[model samples]
Target: MLNSAYLCGMQKYKVHGALTAVGMIYGVNYSIAKEVMPHYIQPFGFTLLRVGAATFLFWCYHFIHGGESIDIKKNLPRLLLCAVLGVSANQLFFLAGLNLTSPINAALIMTVTPVLVLLSSALLLKERVTAKKALGIGLGLSGAVLLVLQQGESTAQGGMLGDILIFLNASSYGLYLVLVRPLMQRYKAATIVKWIFLFGFFMVLPFGWEEFSSTSWQTIPPLIWLAIIYVVVFTTFVAYMLNAWTLRYVNSSVVGIYIYLQPIFASFTAVLLQQDQLTPQKLLFSLLIFSGVYLVSRK
Candidate 1:
């Protein structure tokens, strides 16, 4: 017999911890992953390693505590679509973009995801929208423009093309967030996790195979090996699992707000390490995006 207050307390802790952990991982991942690409491995190859390893881990988790089977007839098609947008396209564009662009830019661009999801909900789910949410979306998109325009000003060196790809990646993932919601009500996160990675595994293999094959493992340093493991295990595997766990305790709006912290972690860490430089232009645009996300994410 638990009281409502106690349960509420526990949920708040769980929700906050989960969202913070997720933000830190994504924020740090941008830099860590950047270290590995072009130098040790290409973008597609690195993505292959990430999705492949994650897929295997998900299946292993399923084996230990697998739940009832998913409904194949009605859900398989939906799952496939989710795989394409959520896992395959999302991972592909992101890695490709990150390889070409600076990590700070990538992190800042990701802040728009909530705005994208909100708009999609309004259009696709026919959810009612208010003025605040609309302004938030506008501000969020506008901030991205500000950041894009300031590309060369900061120490970040990626080209305009990279930023464009990352924007596309964010768009794909935002759509995934919208589409996966209904399916989430129908299935356990564990069950869906396995399928999403498996489908993504196949989708990425062809594109990644050549680059993955060309890479020579012998040349990679121990530090890079550790980074690879981090991407495979922590960023891809644990992050996703934690996100699913956190969703059980908090609403999606709360989850969206946590995303705002990612750029903070990413930019601070990158600047501290001297891997990236901070500029006034970035700060100005970051303010716009953060304010936008805040407005959009507010109830």
Candidate 2:
């Protein structure tokens, strides 16, 4: 009984720990990935690199750990859909949007994900949404709108477009969380992600190939190379794996509420790197975002 209890406690710690780590990695990723886009590599090119490299890594890991074959016929269509929403659309929109917007703005905009997830769950998974969750959704939406309004007109077109794309990315991701949950029960996280990346590679290929080919690799500096490596390895490979594993232990909305922590880490990193500022308005908006996610996540 003691051993079983100890294992259960440890398992809980690991699951939550993995989720926290994913948030931190992704928070830092916003700044790191922003530094590489539209200069050293275009968004599409960078996304291709991210998805392609991650696919290779996932496959390599799967091979090393005693190769397991999935029920291809049964799971292929769902896996392909997962690839489109989770890998292709998610990465492509995020990188493209991050390129056009400030890392802080991008991070703040992502705070709507939990709200989106809750709504998606309610609609698709037949999950319940309490009055508190509805209030939370309203709060999150207000925060996103306020953040957009906070931006000056100097870069309105680009910033607005970027914000919209980020919202789309969040929507795709939110729905993905709901859609992928069923598969989580039937397969290992690695198994699901490996196939997702494989299909994602093809889905993104047509869109990203030209930009990827146009990149002048030899002119790139070491720091940019390091950033690129971080995006592919940590942001793409490790983060997805952690999220997939966490889903096996919790609801998709529970997994998504962790996005509330992202802007804190993102702003801190951006400030440290002199990439963005920490203003009072941003703080107030972030509070609303935090409050909303907190309400939505309450049991």
Candidate 3:
């Protein structure tokens, strides 16, 4: 019995570690990705770049590891749906929104994803939202809101339309988490993501091809190119892989709740980079966010 408990604890620790890694990757990506879009590349063009490169990487990873092939006949339809929700629509709206909004606004708005996931899980997966989980989500959200607001008027940099698109992105992602949870149980993460990105590539090609073709690729600086690579490799490929793998060990709600950590990671990065200073107010908000994460993560 003691051995079994120890194994279970270690498994949970690994799952949380993966989720935290994803949070850090995505937290940094908000600024890195935002810096490249709408100037060097339009949102759709950037989406194409991100999805296309990620699709290639996922397939290459699958081949290198000898991952099993998916059942196209039975799973293709579901994979297509996931492509729409998880990849194409999700990425499109996010980049577009980020182009129109400030990075802080984008990160803060994304914190609402856990609430959407909690509600979706109850309605679709029929998963019960215990009172503890609900409270945790509420506290996390409050902290995120306070943090964003305290940043002063600059928080609304992108305006109402951008904010609305960010909300839509969050909604799509939350639903994708619930829907994709079952697929994680049935297939290897690489097999599923590779197929999803393949479908997503075709989906975004129509909207992005013209923008992609028109870009003056020669004018883009090397640093911006590096940012693009980071978005494609770390945020799109590695983060997605980690999120999908973690879902196999925990419920979708637990996966969603980890998003609350993103803003905290983002803030800490700013402090480390000397872009922002740490203050008591920021510390209080961090406490609230961490407390919420703890409550929801309780076994």
Weakest ten-residue segment in model 2 by summed lDDT: 1-10
Q: Stretches of candidate 3 above 4 Å error?
A: 1-7, 154-156
User: What TM-score does each of the candidates earn?
Assistant: 0.83, 0.86, 0.95
Instruction: Score residue 276 of candidate 2 by CA lDDT.
Output: 61
Give per-residue CA lDDT, model 1, range 66-158, as digits (tens): 676888678888889889987888898999999988886787677777777767766886656678767766776676656644544453456
Give the clashing pairs for model 3: none
Rank ordering of all candidates by lDDT, starting from the highest: 3, 2, 1
lDDT tens readout by residue for model 2, 1-299: 01112335578678767877998899899878878989899999889999999999999999899556689899888888888999899988998898888776777678788878987888888876678867876776676556545644233445888988898899899989989988876788999999999999999999899999999999999999999999889998899999998788777887887787676677678678775677899788778866876675555
The numbered model that scores best in lDDT is 3
The TM-score measured for candidate 2 stands at 0.86
Which digits, one per residue and each the tens of the lDDT, describe model 3 over residues 205-288?
998889889998999999999999999999999999999987777778888988988888778877787878889998999899
